[model samples]
Target: MNDLQQQLAAIVGPAHVLTGEAELASYLTDWRGRYRGRALALVKPGSTDEVAAVVRACAAAGVPMVPQGGNTSLCGAATPDQGGRSVLVNLSRLNRIRQIDAANNAITVEAGCLLAQVQEAAAAAGRLFPLALASEGSCQIGGNLSTNAGGVQVLRYGNTRELTLGLEVVLPDGCLWNGLTALRKDNTGYDLKDLFIGAEGTLGIITAAVLKLFPRPRAVVTAWLAVADGAAAIALLGRAQARFDARLTAFELISRQSLDLVLQHIPGSRQPLAAPAPWQVLLELADGGAWADLQADLEDFIGGEMADGRVQDGVLAQNETQARQLWALRENISEAQKIEGLSIKHDISVPVSRIPEFLDLAGTALAAAFPGVRVVAFGHAGDGNLHYNLSKAQRQDNDAFIAATPQANRIVHDLVARLGGSISAEHGIGQLKREELVRYKDPVGLDLMRCIKSSLDPRGLMNPGKIL
Candidate 1:
């Protein structure tokens, strides 16, 4: 081992430092296999002090460092570069739930804690963490915070940024900043925790965090509604929101093509509606009230919508098992799409009112540009975030279609930009969207972000080539 590797081994112990190619292979690539990189060494730090030591060692050697959590990044934020000069500092060993204050509705946890584990912890305390994602089983809280992840629950609880109360980060220079406070009403200056939340590890390494929790819902109602089109879906969403108010926890929109792929690929998956419509909506209402009343209210609302032209057909989940099965259909969209074939994906957002326009304009523009391109649109419609993806029916033609990602992105993202929408809604700009970020980000905002990055990590050794 070289001197630097030896020093890292000394800090975290020899067994925790991995340099073999086979040992480092899994840590090199992203979850979707879109990005693969080489690292000088993979260091597993067990505590904040150990992480600080590892950072110091890398800084002294003038080598870059990639702070990795669960390695489930969609944008390759945690993956190192192809240069093979950087070190991967994995935080899985630091998984720990330090404290949970039921009265304060907060939980303090280390960065390496799996999201599911945190959720279970909150449930054990008779509370809800509110940030729910399909990859919750494997993704870590630090990564969720770093990406400012938004899932189906974002419609009600907000994104990870809003759920975060405080953070503890390791500076690029090896200094640890402990700001893990559970206070909900702190009139502190600048709110330093917000800087590292969505910075995608560019600003610093998030080691631990204090997360906000919510009261556990005593009852939940899940329903699948078939709608005429995006416009009808939005109209129904508005009606549901006005009626249910805060009880509306999730409102996801799924295209017919998206549902078809799920039914074709995902085993045991059945279509909720007897006949498929052009669009489908999965709506959920959670409240502390009685379950029977909640279900009746949802049924009544759906009945009225069906009486109008808003809803074509609808089915309410009768039990928890049925509700989970209904949720499975929505959550399995991405996996089914992957099983079908390769496609270019976009996670963009606009105002809720303009969702119909975005779908229409972007769909028309893409069809004009690439003939026979299947647009798979589905996501949290209540928040106007859509996982808009494109693929050709013929797998043989996908190569050419994939090569035209830039053109497709231009058509879609230009429309999003024109509509005052974000090119990347929940996903962070890692290596995947760096150029697009530069293209769409405002000049003044970009300058300020760069200034903050420079101020925090002047050497640019902390997760280089990410989010900037």
Candidate 2:
């Protein structure tokens, strides 16, 4: 073993330090198979102190360090570079729920804890940690915080940024910043936690965090409704917000193309409605009231919409089993898409009102550019973020079209920029969107970001080749 490898092995038992190519293969490649890189070694540290020690050693040796958790990044945020000069610091061994203060409505946990684990812990204490995502079962808290991930429940609960209360990070120089406070209101100075929460491990390595929790809803309802198009869905969203307000937990918009892909690729997947529509909405309502009353109220609302022909058709989940089945249809879109084939994907967000315009323009432009291009659009319309993906219908054509990703991205991202939208909503600017970020990011804002990065990591040793 090399000197640094030996030091890493000593810091966290030899069993935790991985050097074999087979042992490091999975950590090197991203889940989407889009990014594969080489690393000096993959080291798993069991505690925050060990992580700090490893970071100090790497910093002293002038080796780049890449902080990785869960390895489920859609944007390759956790993957290393091709240089093979950096050490991959895997934080999975630091999984631990340090504290659960039910009264304080907060929980402190290590970065390696799976998002699902944190959610379960919150539920056990009669609280809700509402950072719901499709990959929550495998994705870890550190990555979620690093990417500021948004999911179906973002309409009501906001993203990871809002759910986070404090952070414990190991800076580039190996100093530990313990801002792990549970307080909600503290305007003492600049919010340091915010800087690390969405920094994508570029400035430092996050070791642990304190996250906020909400009252567990006693009553919950889920439903699937059919809408004519984006405009109709947005109109329905406005009405639903007017009536249900905070009771509405999620409002997802799915294109017929996207739903068809899911049904065709995902086994046992069935249509939520008897009649098919061009667009569909999967929404949920939750409160601490009686379930029967909440269900009845939603039923009345749906009856009124259907009577007016505003909603084409709909089905309300009868029970928890039905609810899970309905949600499965929405959550499995990405998996189904992967099964179909490779796609040029874009995670963009415009103002809630301009989503229809963005969709109409981008769809028309893409169709004009490449006929028979299949566009799979779906996501949390409640937050104006949409997962827009494109590919040709046939495998041969798609294989060729994959090479035109730059052109497809220009069409979609230009529309996003013109509409004052973000090229990356929930997904971080990993290797995938680094170019797009440069093209669209404001010059002044970009300069400030670079300055901050330099200030925190002068040598650029932290997660090199990501973000800025």
Task: Name the top lDDT candidate.
Answer: 2
The 10-residue segment of model 2 with minimum total lDDT is 268-277
TM-score of each: 0.99, 0.99
Candidate 2 lDDT by residue in tens digits, 1-468: 399999999999999998889989999999899999999999999999999999999999999999999999999889999999899999999899999999999999999999999999999999999999999999999999999999999999999999999999999999999999999999999999999988999999999999999999999999899988899999999999999999999999999999999899999899888878999999999999999999999999999999999999999999999999989999999999889889999999999999899889999999999989999999999999999999988999999999999999999999899999999999989999888899999999999999999999999999999997
User: What residue pairs clash in candidate 2, if any at all?
Assistant: none
Assess the local accuracy of residue 338 in candidate 1 as a C-alpha lDDT between 0 and 100. 78
Poorest 10 consecutive residues by lDDT, candidate 1: 181-190
Clashes of each: 0, 0
lDDT of 1 by residue, 1-468 (tens): 399999998999999999999999999999878999999999999999999999988998899999999999989999999999999999999899999999999999999999999999999999999998988999999999999999999999999999999999999999999999888888968899999999888888899999999999999999999998999999999889899999999999999999999999999999898898899999999999999999999999999888986799999999999999998998899899878888999999999999999999999888888999999999999999999999998988988999999999999999999999998998888899999999999999999999999998899999999988
